[model samples]
Target: MDTILIVNPKGGSGKTTLVTNLAGYLARQGEMVNLIDTDKQKSSIAWLKHRSPHLPTIFSTHTHNFANFSVKPSWSIIDTPAGLNEEILKKLLKKVDLVIVPIQPSFFDFQATQSFLEILNTKKPIRKGQTSVALVGMRVHPRTITAQQLEDFLKRQGFPIFTYIHDAQIYLQMASKGFTLFDLSPAKAKTHIEQWQPITEWIQNAHKI
Candidate 1:
């Protein structure tokens, strides 16, 4: 299975949003996807409970029983909790093929992400190029100073910034119903889908690397 880890040391950085949406997209494409929630809040797992039977299936299991899946999955997406410790983070980093770090455009978020990225760089998988790391800007507004600053900060971190997902009520609305942009019609979610293009493409390419 291709494993993708979504992480941010700061809370409210849109980790759950990215996790569910990516799983939804893969499921829509006829891939069996598994979601692993490491957050004590269990927000991602709770979202799974709210998913309608009509939508694509995304299987999930507790963090401890990660290898106990009944159905083998093509993709596994992990939603990590905030304030993750170095030892645990290193353990999780060793097995994943990719790491996607999302940050809201702000000073505090930037500082926290910077520190986290430093830690990532020191990991064996990352230093040896066994795991790919990328960044995504969450709740960004184009042409804003903070957004531009965020882009600049991330660019300087020596990792690619796949895309910047703008602030949209649609994400919140869909999450309430256990839905993602992929579940919406093209006309209804065109812009957001466009933003996700680079992210999905990177995942596909990461498998090759």
Candidate 2:
């Protein structure tokens, strides 16, 4: 099974949003997707509770201690807590296939993201290529000064920015409804889901690892 870890020691950085939407996308594609919420906030669990039964199935679990991990599926999406410590991150990285750090295009979250990336780079798995890591900028407006600043910052850090999610209220609306753009009719969500194509492609290709 492939494991994807969405982590950033910064609150309101869109970690849960990334986890649920990606889970929805994978499940809709008929992949056996399981979402594990490790955050104390239990945001993913709340979203699961609101998920419509009519939609495609996505098995989920909420665990604070990170134990009793026995279920296996095509994809395992783990959402970590904000302000996570390096020791715990080290443990999580040992089992992850890919690590996705979601951040907003703002100075408010930049410090935390930079510090977290530094710690991630030091982890044995990431350094040894036992796991791959990528960055995703969420709620961004392309061509704006903020966006340009974000791009410049990432470029200096030497981290690949796989994609940028446009700043759209529809994503917030979808979360309240327990659905992702992928759950909507292709025509309705065409643009939003298209923004996620790079992420999906990376995840799909990462399955080989």
Candidate 1 lDDT: 0.89
lDDT of 2 by residue, 48-87 (tens): 8899999999899888766446448989999988888887
Segments in model 1 whose C-alpha atoms lie over 4 Å from true places: 64-72
Q: For candidate 2, what is the TM-score?
A: 0.96
Best by TM-score: 2
Report the lDDT tens digits of candidate 1 across residue range 20-111.
Answer: 99999999988889898888889999888899999989889657433343324778898988888888887787668899999999999988
Clashing pairs in 2: none
Report the Cα RMSD per candidate.
Answer: 1.9, 1.1
lDDT of each: 0.89, 0.88
Q: Using alpha carbons, what is the TM-score of model 1?
A: 0.95
RMSD of 2: 1.1
What would the TM-scores of all predictions be?
Answer: 0.95, 0.96
